[model samples]
Target: MKSPLAGLSKFDFFGVLLLRIGVGAVLAFHGYPILTGGGSVWTDVGKGAAIASLPPSFFEYAGLASGILQFIGGILLIIGMFTRGTALLLSIVVGFAIANLIAAGSFQLGFLAHLQMILALLGLVFIGPGRLSLDRKGI
Candidate 1:
């Protein structure tokens, strides 16, 4: 069967671009403090993991890994380079953030924000970066 997206138009491209930039900006902002702040962020992550009864090593590695992924993935998303892969990775990070929030009993705006980020990233993964992206050899 033919792909449903075969008829994608310029408007679809613009929409995807908007979503990509918005999601990327949010991820980058969140990741920035963690990247520059040092191990304190990981310590908090470890504390949360401990409270959640997760393995200690998870905080050690996953914390660092998530930070790097978010920062780099956000940049890639903004540039529209490797858009699908970047969105997929960032979606995973957002999923983890939601899980962490739930485990910490943080049923607040932060959780909602991460949930939205996850949805947006997943949308990008499915819809692609659009014709205006580097992925499409556009400026």
Candidate 2:
């Protein structure tokens, strides 16, 4: 008796679903602190964008916005709602941050996570949400 899921060997959609769940959970966890961190946390997050040379207050607001995007976008990814659009926006944000880190000569071990995120986002953008997603069922 072969495995019950042996027939699913060719089922790539399950892979997409797993990817969405894994990445979505990570992003949601990542955003939770920043989202609830208030002014200080926002300030810290904004500092990453300081390369833009914007005003101090602008950094704080930008951080808050980043938190919201990650939190909300993560949820959308998990449920397969607005999957492509959400992943597209997240790709932009992740790409910018990764580029900045590389520019800053911070290519350390921690940088791998950002690299993985960008790749995953790109995959989602190109492959779509698949039939397991709400986007597919018109939900």
- What TM-score would every model get versus the actual structure? 0.79, 0.88
Question: Per-residue lDDT tens digits of candidate 1, residues 11-86?
Answer: 7778778888888888888878777656768666545534447766666666677778888888888888999999
Best by TM-score: 2
lDDT of 2 by residue, 5-76 (tens): 888878878899999988888888888898999999998887786666678898899788888888989999
Assess candidate 1 and give its TM-score to the true structure.
0.79
- Model 1, position 65: C-alpha lDDT score: 72
Off by over 4 Å in 1: 1-10, 46-58, 137-139
How far off is residue 88 in model 1, in Å? 0.8
Top lDDT model:
2
